[model samples]
Target chain A: MIARLRDGLAVYFCLLRGALAARMTDRADLGISMIIMLLADLVVPLTTLLVYQHGAGFTGWQRDEALLLQATFLIAKGIAFPFCFGMIWTTTELVREGTFELLLLKPRSTLLLLLGHSFQPEDTGKLLGGIALFCLALPNVTIGADADSSAALLGFAALLLLAVLTLFGFALLMTCLSFVWIGNSRLQEIFDAVSAFALYPHGIFTRSALGWLTWVIPVSVLGYLPASVLLGRPDPALPLAVGGALCFVLVVIGLWRMMLARYASAGG
Target chain B: MNRLLAAWRSTCAIAYATYQEWAAYRSHMLISLFIGPTYFLVQVVIWQALLADGGTIGGYDRTALMSYYGAVLIVSTLVFDFADWNLQMLIRSGKFLTVLLRPMSHRGFALSQKLGHRCLGLWMEALPIWLILWLVFSIRLVPASTGWFVLSLALGFLIMFLVNYCVGTLAFWLTRTAGARRLIGFLRDVCAGVFLPLALFPHELQQLLFFLPFQFITYVPVQVLLGHYELAGIRLGIPEIVGCQALMALLMWGLSELLWRLGIRRFSAAGA
Candidate 1:
């Protein structure tokens, strides 16, 4: 099992390196794309800033705290987008052009191969923006150095991992949809709209909406839950939300397998 | 007069054909019905919580803020243009040569295509989203003055097309323009008051945005719809601002034409 894991890592890194090399052919475009990715994600945070500056804010959340929550979402997106999210678009194009069979013929797991080959270096701008905002906001918020702070840090770390996994699940789900949906480029826009709810404080949402976000859609895991945990104000439903996120990922994986089985290649 | 009539007829034909071509992707357009409302819902939740105490932000009460966002969604649906993306793809793949071979100006053809696409969007995206905003959100988007609003919105549409066309012109020089296009497009949207109202911006930033051509695209139209125009401490009646929007549209047309002339000289689709 260890040997197989090592082999998988080796294959993933090799394919990632190739993707990087291909993207490096256009360094200027790569740099601009990265900046664009960063700027695009910063829009919500900017609006939050302007709102607070204008003496309005999400109830129960301070300006910096709200920024921190949005920063957490951006960081999660920063991590997932460059790594996993490209699979959706790649699958769309590959399937549309009847070239998806090329990936299927590889000896490696098709999922692994697809994930590896779809690395997007430009999206690292999102990571940079997130980290920058995180650093900027972390200084302003108070965190006691007591045991609870430590526990909160631990919970935040765990929830952040779950957040990344949740995003991966979403990417996987969209990729699976792309198999049959064909030529539909608005999948990302739909995801963008849904996940946008994660950028704000949970206090802003109505009880029903909050329940849906936490228990059904697992949107809370993407940012709000992790940020809340780090703020040392963990939601009472944290454990349940975590479980929902895990189940969501598991369901997505199952869906991916079913779709793969159904994918009677474009036969290019 | 006969030549002008022929131009009008061909424009209509092109628009109708483009509309039919895109009707196959109506489901794609219908997705906006979901996305627009979802976004508005998020805004609703946030603003409802913020102003629950009866506090106003930037001189807007909850009702006015809701109207602003609702108008934004509707106007955005009407004036939306992907001409930049379409044109860049054409240029990159050397498919624009086919356009040049046609008698009509590529700009005119692209505008006709946008008209067709937006006609579809008006029904599939704008109208339904308008109903959702009205029926579900209880946000009534009664324009301050209907005639001036319509005129301003038409100007907004023209400005948006000109700006995107100029961005597409960059593909003639750059081997890859996706990043540049996105960067410019995003900045344009930001300045145009898409994500946040211009009133929410700092005084200095608002002043700077006033000089930029983008606010003519969405901000002016929304403000005209809302029946008030004030940004960066400058106030204008609907007629005056709409006039300014028209002037900006003409300026954008001149800029786009200049860029097209300069960029077209660089086009080399020898093999393609």
Candidate 2:
């Protein structure tokens, strides 16, 4: 499995490089896409900081801690970007245009093939922004600098990767809804709308009934729960992060397999 | 006067025809209805959370925030224009030539058609949600001052329409206005207090955003409806909100018309 995964990663990178090469011909679009992405990354955190400092401090987390949550969101978006962002919309077009059939004849799983084909080169900027924000925000966590706790930090990093995987799984689930709701672009718009809710600090929703939504939907887990755990906030429910990730993986794989059986390929 | 009346009547007829075309897609309309409500519900949930801690944000309490967001959902749906998207498509497909040969003014036809679509769309999707919120949430209204609210909303609509037209006109030169649209949308969402109350923005940013036109389209009308302005009962304060909205509306409308003329001239010269 590890070998296959490595091979898949190698193939994915090669395909991504090809896409980047193709995108380079359209340098103007690439430049605009980069600027938009940089602006998106900058605006969210800045808006949060402005809103919190002006209105009231965040309910559960301080400014630096909230920035960490924002960083987690950017990182999750970065991880999902290379794989999901381009494919979600393009998949609908493929299905509508009956071009998806060309994808199924490939040697690999169609999911992996689609994932490899749909890389957005501009998201590299987003990924770098996420890392920069994470690094900048990292120092604000008051955890003592002890060499022994490096293991816990490593564990946390692993959990963060799991969180990204879960987010991708969920995004895939939303995109796959297009297969079921064919010809209705409103589903895509609705997904965009719901995803907008994830842009803010999840601690804002602490006592509301929709707080369950943050956990069950794992929108907050993409940022809030992992950030909270890493910041060493006392929460007995920290283990749920691992559980959510596992469930997300299992459910997403299960759903994709089920849908794969029903996918009638659009002629390429 | 008769000519103007006839033009208005013909415009209304075209609008009705467009509405009928939209109505033909029942499944699409139903899906839109479902999506619209769900989107508003999510906004409500977010605002509820923001106000959950019983803390004041920008001097807005929980109920006030709910009323503001609920009003925004309704007002935005009502005033929203899709002419930008339409303009982009027209420019890309070179459909403006067809409009240029028509008897009526292109801008007039485009604006009226959008107005008709908005009216039809609101009746189909937004009105029910607005009524439900009003009844269920006891959303406060600026009663006996219906004129003030209506006039403010009109100004808001004009601002929204002009801004969309201006942004869409950029497509003539830029080839693709999606980037501009996205940036505009982001700015609008933040500054117009669509996601949260604009008051929550830092005083500096809020002041800066006041110079930008997005606030006129969404925030002001919502504020008017929620009776945020210092007006005593039974007194009309249309001038305050309406004045600002009218000024911005005129500025944006003038700028958009200028751009549209220049853009069309460029396209004509290029034979695009």
Candidate 3:
């Protein structure tokens, strides 16, 4: 299992390097895209801060706790930037345009190839801005004041990586659904819209109904649960994280195989 | 009079064409029906949680906030223009030539097409949701006066439509304006009170947002609908909303036309 994981990571990095090379050829355009993404990254958290300050307390969480949640979201978004958003759009487009045939000819797995082709050089800017925010908010985070910063950061990182995997897997699964359903663009839009809810602190959604949706939909997992754990709030079910991570991997693998089976070659 | 008739006829034809375009993609529409409501449900759930402890967050109660957000979702979606996507495609495909050659004004045609699309969206999608909300929630109206509510809501759609057009027309100057579209979208959601009530924002930010035209698009209209604005309040607010929208619309219109002319000149000079 370890060796297989290592191999997958290696392939992922190799694909990323190739994408970077392709994007670097248009440095000026890439720079503009990056700037735009960075601006977008700042708008959400800043706006949320403004909202929280005005509202005083969000659900039960205080102002600082809300800020910490926003920071964690930024961190998870930083992880997602390079990993998922770049690929999801292209995956949908390829399926729609019947361009997956070219991908099939590639030696790499089609899922990886599709994701690899979808890299946005601009996302690096979003990642950097997120990192900057995370750093700025790191010291102010008091929810987990008892825990060592190092331990919290490590735990945060683990949860963030898990979140990204879950998000990417979910996106992949959605893209694969396009194989069965034509004109699934609305599904993509719905995904985009629902994901926007992640911008707010999840503490605002502590009720059981919303909680179920968060866990089942896994959008809250992207930022909320991990942030909670890191902040030294009562730990969420460990099994939830482990189960979600396992489900993500299994789902992605299943969807990829299903997509491959349905792959009718586009005309060369 | 004849010109008005001609314009009306052309607008009707354009409206039909817009409907047909959307109708051709039946699957997308069906999916949108499912998807839009599901996303709205998620938002409702979140808001429900926030309000569970009772209202009075940033001076908004649960019912009021629901009315505001429900109006936001319905109104924003109703007034949304695909002009940005259209402008981008036109520029990329070098099809601005066809639009320019037409005897009718391109801007007029574009605006008509957008309004037509929005109208179709309202009939096909929004009306159902509005009916459902009215039936299920018995959503209370705040503006008290029906006439005022209707007028304000119309103005809201107009402001939103103009903003979309102005933003989209920037594509004439910028090679790619997706960033601008996204930025404007984010602004609309945050400042315009689509995601949360604008009342929930810090007083300073709320004050600043009041100055911006975005609030006129979604926030003020919804506020009016929820009876947050009175006839007296409308006397003060309506002028501000309309004046700001008109000023922004004129400024954007003039700027986009200038850019469009310049872009056309550039294209012609380059022998494209």
Candidate 4:
């Protein structure tokens, strides 16, 4: 098992089995950790739940609708975290300690190996919390029974995957930023500062601010757009949103490859 | 008395070193300086959306709401403590040995370092952020009394530092406390009203929060700044709030010191 962990190029199942075994060795400990994270995930929604109940909610969202949006954000974050978002810190540490070069030299795909190494299985608790909240709020929300409802649900699932990919691209950018700013990198914190806006409904923001989030940072891809599909809203920009997300994924992937190539030649 | 004086002098030297260390990284710290302003901007937009029809949120009008958000940024930055993360890094890197060999307690060293770091932050981040909020958003900070405002804020710094100090000492038992610290930090941010004003919470929840020292960190100081303390029935004025905060800080310090003492025993046994 240890050897499997040391060798990232080992079979995918072998890597996952080794990780599961190690994490399962202390099941109670793992459970406690997950519970702690789940509680943390609940805090923001709980606060917002109280705030809405107290009679102040966003422009287009009441208590239940706001909960749905918050749950959407959490679900996306939870899914993205274990696979991609958490790796931002891992890559930053690697670049800082000069071991990132060693990672590049590995036989397998570097990004895949990074993902395996940085997998945070405990973050599933976040996903579970989001699902629980979504379930509680779903019935309170009305969805059209027409053919568009099925299409919107499918779109919600597909767009959810793209949203996670969009976040991965941002993480890739932050990794490159870490390389440029060797000692201290608050680039990720800037991402976080911007991401706080994602917690609220998009209608709360000005048109220009929404435009910026949609195109520049694309944070709405993480929550608002996905929730729109779930709510069966006839989004005129559905095609635009999908095309923009795909283009962003391509651009960041290209940038990540370029950065990797530069690291190969520069050696520093 | 002589030994206490010596330890005090040594801590002062450590604080000076920490201040210089942070000063050298000022440019890197600029990102954090911008976080407050960015966060306040988001709050302004959100409240604007909520109050578009010109309604109050938990008794706060639009201008009052903006000022409260601005006040929160100032206080949260002022009282921010990273002892938990710092301790985790020190322990992970095996540099905690240097701390163990010192005559003074790690809490004292960490607290002194925090003090010097925040003293710089007061000028570098907090004040400038306040000025920007005022100039850009026209969010006026109308403190009922400067004496109480400063007093509450100073006490808040001590209380938050001690809470974080207790959390940091848990590193002795846990190998990696990044997640734990982050969770605690998140709770503190929420419970302390950094995310939203505590007034916006339900009355029952707000009453429950009064018992937790987290409220003293950002909410109390902000309340004093907004003159909401008088509205909350703080009839005794500046001295009473100052005294209450000092009492909370003392209690937290005692509890944290007890934990540290016990934790160090476990740590020494583990040769960590």
Candidate 5:
């Protein structure tokens, strides 16, 4: 089992290296794309900053606290997007061309192969942006001075893992849907609108919206829950939200298999 | 007169054909029905929370701010154009040679296509979202002056297409323009006040924005819809800003034409 896992990791890195080399052929475009990705993700945070500067802020959340919350979401997105989000676009195009079967014929897991081949180096800019924002906000906001700092950090690490896993689940779900939906590009927009909620403090949402975000959709785990943990203020529903995220990931994996079985060649 | 009539008819034919081509993808536009309102709802929640203490930001109370966002949604939906992507793809794939073989100007053809696409968007995206803003959000977008708002929006549509066409022309020089396109597009949206009111920006930045053409795309139109225009501490009436929008649109048209003339000389395409 260890050997199998090592082999999978080796193949994934090999594929990722190839993607990076190909992208590096256009050095200027690569740099520009990375900058664009970072700037695109920073718009909301900038808006939040301007709001605070204008004397209007999210109630009960200080400026730095809100920034930290959003920066955590960006960091999770940064980690997920480069590693997993490419599968959706890849699936859409391959399915359109009836070329997805090439993956099934490979000796490895098709999902792993897809994930391996879909590494987007440009999206690492999101990670960099997240870290920058996180650093900028961390010093201003106190975290676990009164309580156990190490425990809060450990809790943060665990929730961030779940956050990244939930994003991976979202990518997998979208990729699976692409196999059947075929040629639809608006799937990401839907996710963007829904996930926009994850960037803000949970205090803003209505009681029912909070329930939907935490239990039904599990978006709260994507950023809010993890950031809340780091701030030494984990949500009362933290355990339940984590369970929901895990369940969400499992359901997405099942849906991926079902969709793969249903996929029929559209190419002649 | 005969020649003019022929051109008009040709434009109509092109627009109708483009309309039919996109009608099959009506589901794509319907997605906007979901995305636009959802984004507005986020804004509603954020702004509602921010202003829960009964204070104003940038000369806008809670209701005014909601109305501003509502105007942004509807105005953006009306003036949205992807001519840059279409043109860049045509250039990069060497499909532009086919356009050159035609008697009509490619710019005119693209504009006609945009007209058709936006006509479809008007019903599919803008109107529905407007209704939602009115019904669901209770943010009625009653324009301060309907005539001026329509005129400004029309100019905004022209300006949007022209600015993007200028960016698309960069494919003539760059081997990869996707990065540049995205960067420019995001900057344009930022300068145009899509994410937040330009008035919220620092005074120096707002002063600089007043001179940039991007503001003519969304900011001026939204301000026109709201019945007043002010940025960089400068204020103008609805008719005055609409006039300025027209002038900016004309300037953008000239700029696009100049770039197209220079860029087309670099086009080299062999038959596939």
Candidate 6:
């Protein structure tokens, strides 16, 4: 078991190193790309400042808490973007150009290979921006200085993992759709609208709307739940919401397999 | 005069062909039908959440904000520029040589295609948008005159085209600019008040933004539709702001032309 685990680790690192090496050749382009995406990361904090200065915020959340929610989102975006958020586009191009056959020839899992092969280090700018926002908002957020605070922070950290997983799951689902529907990039556009909607506080939504985004769409899992956990005001529906997201991921993986099965290589 | 007439004829022919190309599609038409209204609804919902009591937020009361955004839904949609994405692709794929191989300038072709797309968009999107705004939001264009509003819309289109065209021309020097275009395009959309009223911005910042051409893209035209725009803390009536926007649009058009001339000389097909 130890040897097998070590072999898997070796394979993963090999693929990751290859991706990093390819990106390092174009240092200038990578820097510029990161700066460009970082500009988008900066917009949320700016808007939060504007909204709160107007003396209104989402019902239960204060301005600083809203900023924290946005930071959680940006951090997840930054991590997922570098690992797999961009796979939807990469997979579409690969399938369209008939190069996906090369990916299947690899002995490793195709999805794992896709994850490593499409790393976008340029998204680290978003990570930097998120960290900056988190630091700026931390002083203003109302966290108690007690042992319960440590437990809450730990809970918040776990929810952050859940947010990243949900985000990556969404990207994987989109990538699967690209395999099934070659040249139909329009379906990918809806991801933009869905994500843009996800940045708001959960309070802005009604109970029904909240349930829908949480259970049906899992958009709330992207940012709101983690932020809510940190604020010590997690909804009574937390377990159902998290279970719904896990079930959604399971559904997405099943769909992904079906899509992969349907894909007949253009090269063949 | 003969040369000018030939150019005009070429533009019209391309416009006709492109219009037919787009009109053949039903799915894209359906998508266009939703894009404007969906974007407008996002703004409406967010603003509604923030403005819970329905009193003034910045300088805009709730009704005024609704009217501004309602007009925004129409005008911003009409003036949308989709050239930068296509231009970057053409350059990166070495398809731009096809334009140089042809007799007409690339800029002319780009503008003609845009006009065709927007023409179809108008037929499908404009009337439905007005109905939705009127029925749902009770919004109307309260311009000083129909003539000035129409002029403002035309100039806004020209301004949008010029701003995007300038970015598109950067493909001549850059390796691939799709990423740059998306980021800059988002920045433009946000700064131009697609997602919120620029009037909601503090007055000093608004005054500073007034000097930038980005404000002319959507803010000035919407203000013209609303019959007044504030500049330097002075409220300018519709005619004055429209006059200012006309000059800015003309200036951007000239600058885009100059940039295109400079950029084409740097264009190298073999390396691309």
Tens digits of lDDT, candidate 4, B1-272: 99989888887888888888899878666776677788788778877887777888777788888888888888888888888878767766778878889877888888899988987788888888878887888876767889888888888998998898888887788766666777777778888888777766656777777778888888889888877563233344556666777899999999998987887776643335
lDDT of 1 by residue, A1-268 (tens): 9999999999999999999999998899999999999999999898888788878888778898999999998999999999999999999999989999988888999999999999999999999999999999999986533437878888887888899999999999989889877878888888999998999888888799999999899999999898988887778998999999999999999999999888887721
Identify the runs in model 1 with alpha carbons over 4 angstroms from their true place. Answer: A144-146, A266-268, B270-272
Cα deviation at A177, candidate 4, in Å, is 1.5
Q: Where in model 3 is the C-alpha error above 4 Å?
A: A1-32, A39-44, A143-151, A196-211, A234-236, A265-268, B30-55, B132-151, B200-211, B228-259, B269-272
- Which interface RMSD does candidate 6 score? 2.4
Model 5, A200: alpha-carbon shift in Å? 1.0
- DockQ values, each candidate: 0.86, 0.34, 0.35, 0.42, 0.88, 0.36
Docking class of 5: high
Give the lDDT of residue B50 in candidate 6. Answer: 78
- The total number of steric clashes, by the backbone 3 Å criterion, in model 4 comes to 0
- Model 3 has fnat of 0.32
Please provide, for model 5 over B117-224, each residue's C-alpha lDDT reduced to its tens digit, 9 standing for 90 to 100. 999999989999999999999888888888888899999999999999999999888888999999999999999999989998999999999988999999999999
Candidate that beats the other on DockQ, 3 or 4, i.e. the better one: 4
A best-first ranking of the candidates according to their DockQ comes to 5, 1, 4, 6, 3, 2
Provide the global lDDT of candidate 6 against the true structure: 0.79
TM-score of each: 0.97, 0.85, 0.84, 0.90, 0.98, 0.90
Per-residue lDDT of model 2, residues A18-88, tens digit only = 87898777677677776677667766677567656756555666777778877877887787776676777
User: Candidate 1 or 3, higher lDDT?
Assistant: 1
> Per-residue error at B4 for model 5, in Å?
2.1
lDDT of 4 at B179: 63
TM-score of 5: 0.98
Classify candidate 4 by CAPRI docking class. Answer: acceptable
Which residue runs does candidate 2 get wrong by more than 4 Å? A1-15, A41-44, A144-149, A192-211, A264-268, B24-55, B131-144, B202-208, B230-236, B268-271
lDDT of 5 by residue, A1-268 (tens): 9999999999989998998899999999999999999999999999888888887887778999999999999999999999999888988888888888898899998998999889998999999999999999999987865678788889998999899999999999888778667688888888899999999999999999999999888899988898888888888999999999999999999988887777667831
Model 6 lDDT per residue over A98-150, tens place: 99989889887788778777877888888888888888888898763343777
